[model samples]
Target: MKTLKIGNTTVDTVLEWSGNLFDVGAFWPGRSWDAVEAERDWMEPHFIAPKDKSKPGVLAASIHTYVIRTPRHTILVDTCNGNHKTRKTIPPFNNLNTDYMEKMAALGVKPEEVDYVMCTHLHLDHVGWNTKLENGRWVPTFPKARYIFAKTEYDHWFANMNGHAMDGSFEDSVLPVVEAGRADLVENDFAIDDSIWLEPAPGHTPGSVCINLVSGGGSALFTGDCFHHPIQIANPDWSTQFCSDLAGSATARRKIIDKICDTDTYILAAHFMDPTAGRIVRNKDRWKLKI
Candidate 1:
């Protein structure tokens, strides 16, 4: 649990989690055989392999939604896998636990207090908590917040996929907000207020956007799923097989690393081990997470 003042905003929190395979596998469609091999080839040295759920594998980072306190609004970036989310192996997220909300309250922010809700991409986890079960209806989680999304990302993911049947995210996480007139879809480089803006870091997901903040001599980049683990900082080219384009993801990593390293900005990774916030340092012509 570390914090960074990014740009004109304060990225106060990043929640880490651990769960069954279903919670993880659901995101990376081809996670089984390929991901295991990935663990052996690149992840083992820098990470710990999970023995079971109680001792969940660390590589599948249990990280989520970042709370950014901006000058004009309190923004939340990329809500993580939510409670009661249906999956293959992992039981739906903590159906009985109200801690996520509790944590928000402790920080003096209820969903209603959030002025803007921005998502980097609309993966199941990224969008899971966007809506909640209200009297048997899956309704917008942040009742008063405007849910901002990238137009390209929305269209690409909202489009039909190969084998998976689209669940009602279109209905629950997205459409309901739109129907309620709470959604604000914009281009990849959309700006919100002054201190915050979207960085179009595509490839992990077609419309995957990164949130960059700058203010008061501070800056940070909220990298959502661009590089899943700190291990990626070392082997930036080794993308998961499930990535939209492995080569493209690698290229994106190098490009992002170059930009951030050239600056004095702290990185807000959506996933990684504890003390997730760090500076991307160039170690002998290689990038490494310097926590």
Candidate 2:
């Protein structure tokens, strides 16, 4: 777990899993490995796995949640893949049995203690922990918490609920929370308080968003998939294969980089590996993360 203090609030990372999970070629189609290889000096052992004969072009990634404890609220940003969910389309996330809840408990936060559950989007991995299996029925995992979702995002998934690309996550993890009356579908610019709010960052998904936190002279951005890896900092045009609109995703990514580059804001990207927090910096003509 990694902890950071922002103003009077506390942020803790609850990691479910991390590893070299995706093939670079597939993750970023048509992108040349030469560009990524050029940065091997700094990426080795973390962002990009050390080259191995069998697993060439693999990219390191993680699935985790950020627990933000403000003066009055215990908020969770982006719940990772939950345990016992059936994700047939994405084999890696299928029937996961992680100790994610125990990890949260270890952080002194029980399910009922959470004040809000904020999802950046409705992707399979991003919203999987919204609910859990209970008595042969899916139920809201955080019974007392109000799950926040972008209205556009929810509507997109709700309309495509049948055979959606999320591998049944909408029905299993998301719909259950809505049916249980624990969901709050809000606009992309919704704000929880003065210290935290959602910023519109579409492209990966029509309603994708990035949560902003500004408090106590400290600030941070919980970027959901805007930049999956630091490599995107160097190559801002690279959009992941999962992006719904390639051009729009790249545009949003560049806009975000331009907004935070050379600034004090720490970026806590959802898929970044350990030492997951850093600031955006300009390197010569491109951008990079200064951790």
Candidate 3:
């Protein structure tokens, strides 16, 4: 567990996995190799995995959760891919096992101590930890936590819950919590408290949102898949091929970068590799993450 401070609040990172996940061309179809190579001096070995004889030219990402401890609550921003969950479409995340809970316990947070389980969206990776295996059935992992879901986001997926592989995710990861009566469907702009709230940030997903924190004059934005890699900061128009709405994703991505440029607000990226958090800076005509 690594900790950082935002005013009086403390933020801890509990990692699940970090390494090369996909090839650059495969991940960002529209991104030119020249653009990525230009940032090679800064991207090597972390954001962009350096060439290895065995596996060359791969893009890397980290899956982790931000444990935010406010005075009155222990909040989890986004839960990474949970253990033993089914992910057939993406083999890298399929039917896994890991010591994620043990990592959290090391940080002094037990499942029951979690007050709220907030997700930016209901994607397989983001909501996988919402429930766990129990008596051979999916059950809410946090006994005392209230799971928060954005109404628009939930409805979008719920409407097509059976249309694809994601239906399996909703069944195993999301439905169990809602069935337990521990879920709260709120507006995209809902506030958890005076200092913590959600802001509408669509594009990656129709109902995707960013968690905002402002305490003791300090600010940070928990970017939930709005931009998976730091390269997006430099090329805001370069939306990932995985994005369901390319135009909307580009629009929302730029909006977030514009909102944080030259500000003290820390960007806590959900899938950024090491040095996952940083401030946005104006690099001439573009924005760069100053980690």
Candidate 4:
């Protein structure tokens, strides 16, 4: 709801909601449902406790838009959920009706003024609003921007675009944009401009990446889905039960945490609770978010 400047970049946290309802002892691996009560307690102080654990974690359909004011051009990282898309299996993300464009306009960011749009991944929630409905067709949301995608991530998702049929995210959240000629697929550590770069961060999804912004005598990292909660700041090993590759993901999370803990970088977690962006510090031998 507010914009904060990090040197040459402006990070706007456009979020829907932030809570730890989903994994509060109620969530588990595919069939590994035995609640780890102690770990849950370890996670308590780091998360917002919801009375009801029967429901999924309530999250806002929001996007963290980054406006990089560099000498070259302007880039917007990640568009939030758009209106009227086919509902997802999750309740919180279902039938979203928020006005994302209006919020962008309020911040004086027009689609045309945006020269590039970068997506950390192509998940239904992450890339749902990357395109817009125009005259009965889904077109690139940013008319003048070259939509960037990780080459590996794009290929895998594109290959299975409609193969899954039922849960094919590419069909709804991606293909439309590719048809619109706005997608710009690049490498894992893809560098767009001088101050901004995308680091290869796999595990959450095959081609997951995080955005790094350098400016204002400071730095910030837009951790796509690497560390969803600040609790991960304490227990980086306690990955979500649904993570694709737990070991790989944990390694990546540690790497980023180390970099931020040592540098002047702040984190912009897409799903972190209040004090969304901050530094990482060592608590004993473990890491924690220094809010």
Q: What is the number of backbone collisions in each predicted candidate, taken in the order shown?
A: 9, 0, 0, 5
Ranking by lDDT: 2, 3, 1, 4
Model 3: colliding residue pairs? none
The parts of candidate 4 lying over 4 Å away from their true place are 16-21, 26-64, 67-72, 162-168
- CA lDDT of every candidate: 0.69, 0.88, 0.85, 0.67
The model with the greater lDDT, 1 or 3, is 3
Candidate 1's displacement at residue 46, Å, is: 8.9
Which ranges in model 2 have alpha carbons more than 4 Å from their true place?
51-54, 162-165
Relative to the true structure, candidate 1 reaches a TM of 0.82
| Model 2 worst lDDT run, 10 consecutive residues | 48-57
Q: Which candidate tops TM-score?
A: 2
In model 3, which regions exceed 4 Å deviation?
A: 50-55, 162-167
**Between prediction 1 and prediction 2, which has the larger lDDT?**
2
Instruction: Please state the error at residue 12 of candidate 2 in Å.
Output: 1.0
* Candidates 1 and 4, the one with greater TM-score: 4
lDDT (C-alpha) at residue 10 in model 2: 90
* lDDT of model 2, residue 165: 47
lDDT by residue (tens digit), candidate 2, 1-291: 468988999999999878777677888998877888887766666677667732567777899999999999999999888899887877788898998888899999999989999999889889888888889998989999999999999998888774434888888888889889999999999999899999999999899999999999999999899888999988989998888899999999898898899999999999998888889998888888888
* TM-score attained by model 3: 0.95
Residue-pair clashes, model 2: 0
